[model samples]
Target: MTKIQPSAPLRSPHGSLLRRKAKDNPTLASILGSYEKFSTAALSLVVSDKNSVFALVEAFNAYRNEAVYLFESGKNVPQENLRSTMLEELFSWLFKDLFAILQFDQPTNYWAGKATSSYLTLTFAPKNFQSLFEDPNPKISKKDQDFAIGATVAIKVMASKSDDSAPALTVILPVVAIECKTYLAKNHLDMCSATAQSLKRANPYCMYLIATEFLKMDSEVTPEVTDISEIFILCKAENAERKKRQSEGKPPHPMHADVVWELFSMVMGHLRAVWWDPASSLDRGKVIGRPF
Candidate 1:
């Protein structure tokens, strides 16, 4: 099958804050909201210092120590599995939404630079590349292909910024190259290297999104290396209620930094953004320990 490409970029008046303007800006807006909660609470949250290793460990622990409730398909999942699935869904939303922004901005710029006509040249994947999530074996029977690729995920491209009579360059735009991956194994540097190769093979100007934590466990585990420039680490943040009660005799929750890092080492360094919902703050009354 042919590789997929991004359709024409969507044109939005705003910048990254475009998400804030939307009903849901899961990437920048939501993650920053979570950071704000951490800053306002007890633990003095800080970004990376000189030591990337220490910073990675500290940040990973900070987020992992606390647990939160999960809501899925408008319904809450079992507390035991909430964090696990919520993590996946949050990461998926982050990549999908951000790609929409790039698709808009890049093409807008291309059209403006060329001063050309209004039509856009769009190239997209047959199944939105959902096959990566399907069967592990690419070499399957024709009947199994659907099980591997699932439904055709369409990246529809329509006129975004130009009128029909506009000059060829007036509205025409360059296609975007977008890639998303879920890493269950491999270290940061290793993953970066592999992804870099894939991107370079296609186009280095591509937008890359990897839904993996600083420390990834499981069968694909590899050495921990740090070269996370293009990669976006979509992970969680510090739990609000837990920290406020940390000093009071109430011990930290079971999934604290120590526990999470025990399996996947050094998760903070690669962290680019977090998914946050202040709705959890409404549970303040149910909190056990005294606020710091």
Candidate 2:
């Protein structure tokens, strides 16, 4: 009988010191193990949500696949262009599904639009609870009202419309706001934070998100931007670029799949919180259950 050879122990790509530390520390190991399991479960949930979650994943995959194909075909394409195009497409795709799912009544409609807020025109009035513009003691600034430009993607829901004589006043309050970037810079982050803060002041329930292809800022930077609910690094550098960076002793950006899953989880949580109408429960029971 031939003697069977024993397989060598599995090796990690990390340095010996780091590997040793990981091996020695049971708490660290447990945390890592739990994160892995949690990520896996979260990803599964994201992929399984048939409404908008799966559609979002598919859109990202499509863009990545196209980028890979174009690069392989010897086409000279700027990665920034591809990233920008993908972000635009994602905005349309996501909002379309979100609008359909969230829409119920005629006036309460959802759309991708601007969310301009002016401290001069709008004041926080205690007496006039209905309208934001109804302030007893209005303090109008002499200088122009500093306006924070709305994000590329914003979900606006119509609040109320006055009588026939009065022009249909639409309250452009975005429940979901997203800022997309190829590479998120500090200045860009600051701008987004400012915009989000303004929107939140107008409507406290607004959810602000920042999505970038590359993470130029450090992890600690996100916490400092308190207005943003979350930051998603949608896709790292291309495969070739990532390998080159690794070779140069640099860490690669996060994978697209991981970021998509994180985004999906956040969106699903938000939907669960606001999607259902308690009054319509009985009506829903009477009607056949159908996906929007």
Runs in model 1 deviating more than 4 A are 1-37, 40-48, 51-60, 68-202, 205-211, 214-292
Instruction: List lDDT for all candidates, in order.
Output: 0.29, 0.45
Per-residue lDDT of model 2, residues 1-292, tens digit only: 2322212111111122222444765533433343233223323332334443554455445434434333222345332233344454444333333323444432323334223422212443335555543323333211111111122232222323523333233344455666767667778888877776776666565667777776666556664537788777776554355546656855444346556657756664675453435577686663322112
lDDT of 1 by residue, 1-292 (tens): 2322323222211222323432453433444444334323212322223232244344433544432311111245232333333333222211222323333343223321111221213343333354433312222111100001011222333234434442221232212211223223344446455643443333222222343433344445433342222333333322344344454645444322333332122222212222133465465433322111
Of candidate 1, the 10-residue stretch with the lowest lDDT total is 141-150
Which ranges of candidate 2 are over 4 A from the true structure? 1-59, 65-83, 99-108, 113-171, 219-222, 236-255, 274-292
- TM-score per prediction, in order, is 0.25, 0.48
Best candidate (score: lDDT): 2
Model 2 collision count: 0
